[model samples]
Target chain A: MTGAIKSQSGRLTEAEAIERAKQGDGEAFEVLYNLHKRRVYSLCLRMTANTAQAEDLTQEAFLQLFRKIGTFRGESAFSTWLHRMAVNVVLMHLRKKGLPVVPLEDTMETDEDTTKKEPGAQDASLAGAVDRLELQRAVEALPPGYRSIFVLHDVEGFEHNEIAEMVGCSIGNSKSQLHKARLKLRDALKKHRAEKAKR
Target chain B: MNCAEFQKALPEFAEPQRDTALQAHLRSCSDCSLLVSDLDSIVAAAPSLAASEDPNPQIWLQLEAALKNEGLIRQPAAPLLVPPPQEGRGWRLSWALPVAAAVALTIGLLVYRPSTHQNLQSTGKTAVTEPAAAVQTAAATNAGINEDQDLLEVVGTQSPTMRAEYAANLKDVNAYIRDAEDAAKANPDDEQAQESVMNAYEQRSMLYEMAMDRSLP
Candidate 1:
């Protein structure tokens, strides 16, 4: 084991982490897992919504990370490469379940001038306190495909190009979906507030 | 730029270096500003899922087991060395054991008659036949080992991105196999591709099995 395999932190460098992982160092892998597990799990959870499925997805991603770590070339950041892997794992799960990839029927065609809608009684009354919880629910309510792009770009702060690669779509497609997602979310939140006001 | 274009670019605007024009407009445009605020709240409220909180830890346990599974461990397969099967002179000299000498007449009748059916059966037992294919495969493996240089050279040669991509590609291939299998089951009319798909799956599964076997504790 070269010292390069173990960086100054006694953990392997990214390159060495990959090399050692390929050599089947479960401990070294545990180190790699420790480094990225949270981010991986976060992506899985936000993408899938269901905790149970997210857990399974997270495990599968790491097992895959273990099985396929040998092929990780350091062209991009290891996290960037792994982000692609993690995203693929989620997409594969959705595809297996026959979940919709892109809701083509939803073309952001709603004509309602959402800006004209008033904030609802609930949103108006509780205001900022429950706003966080409501916002969380609204995001969770977005379509899976839209939610994923929304989470990656809006929440995780990945660039469109990066999201494009991670989601296996063209850069233009990522941007469009993001635009559509933002529109739909704004519409949904506006509707939620209006419906609450009517109550 | 159009509002649609500008709207899509709002995320990019969240960057510290937003274009001055967009920043100025967003400051005054309540709709766009509220949209940014709403996006901000949504992002701030984004749920954080920790794998540690998962109810079933068995998957990790299985993974640890898989890792610890004697099969996954990288044990240097001590070269399959046959100690030349201890050749002895007793079987050579007497052609038998002490009991065989005592039963000399029976041995003679079985061994001496070259044309006899009984003699053929007895001779077959003494001859140990090795498989040609097995021998050839062993030879090929030996040649492969000779071709490979030291471990470091082989490891050093592979780029890290290649390794990660290789892992990812295998995953993609595995997923394809899974999809093909599902397709085959759903629409058996595509029998030709189905068989080919199944065969590829079997081959890949064998590779996984072999890896698992090698890595097992």
Candidate 2:
């Protein structure tokens, strides 16, 4: 059994586990799930902002990986492939719930107006002063379209082109949505600070 | 470049660049400079937010059951956590009898319904045991429904949040099963529809298994 073998060796390396899992080794599948579940769950949690949904999506994502592990050809890093699959699962769930996954191009033009810095407004420097918890709350407040782009780009560190391919948007659209997402976050954070001041 | 242009280009901007026009604007305008600083802070802080969180432990149990049901697990893996020698053995024995009995009953039903099995075989189709398979499916679905009821009873003992989550998930799976059943009835000859019905039953079974695992004392 793969579990017995792991007990003797301490643990199997990821490559060995992937090879074993491809052969339908249940222990190898568990090893792979343990290796990736945290990051996968975090991605889902950030994307959905709801623990129940995140938990369900995390299960679905791993279920998908298990079903398709036979077809993985190592064309990309395993983590990259898994992350892409996880993103797709979350997006599909969101679409089922009637949330827009991608902002339309016309809406993008209108969104830019909202993102523009006000004319001659005084600027508050958030550099070196932002609270992590506050930022998290602000992130969760973003609209679904902006949240998806923001989490994919800034939080998960996928580049624009890679994100474009995963979400089926142009590279330009990915960057634009990311910038708009940041602007929304900025406004959210500012509002949080203002509310704090009032209290 | 004006403030709008500077902010517009900011998303693509790399730091420490020698763009004199953008640099001059940043040097002159506090708002754009602070905007850049704020956006930079956000990017710098983003990775910290990516810290991984542990999911509920029952997820793996559910996943393992689904894998086994799908025939993706050829070998039964070792238990996830080894309990102390004194524990869980009685619980296992207690449940094992009923489950074994259920399996025996299912097998007995299949053996006694030889006419249905023979009729399917006479049809000369590749799925020669379709009727027998249907009988087994019906038995399994009944078992799944009973397990779901048992799960709901114990689910009330869980935290309200968990109970709500389980109820919502169970409702969704039941709805999926109904849809798949309708599809299978409408297109009885469609292999995909038959597979969908089976998949739906397996999903519900997995959920019940997961809830049962969580309910253990």
TM-score to native of every candidate shown: 0.50, 0.63
- In angstroms, the error of model 2 at B20 is 3.1
Q: Write the per-residue lDDT of candidate 2 for residues B72-161, one digit (tens) a residue.
A: 888766432212325655355335434643453444344334444445557875264666566766775676566555455445443333
User: Cα lDDT for residue B193, model 2?
Assistant: 55
Where does model 2 exceed 4 Å of error?
A1-9, A106-122, B14-18, B80-217
Best by TM-score: 2
In CAPRI terms, where does candidate 1 land?
Answer: incorrect
TM-score of chain A of each: 0.72, 0.84
- lDDT (Cα, tens digit) per residue for candidate 1, span A1-199: 1122332324346566567667875545645664566567667877777767877887788777777777777676787777778888998898788775443434655423323345442122222322433454566788888887887777667788887776578777776677667656666666767765566
Q: What DockQ score does model 1 reach against the true complex?
A: 0.09
**Tens-digit lDDT string for candidate 1 (B60-109):** 44555666664443633222121222465222222222222223223222
Go through the candidates in order and give each one's DockQ: 0.09, 0.23
TM-score of candidate 2 to 2 decimals: 0.63
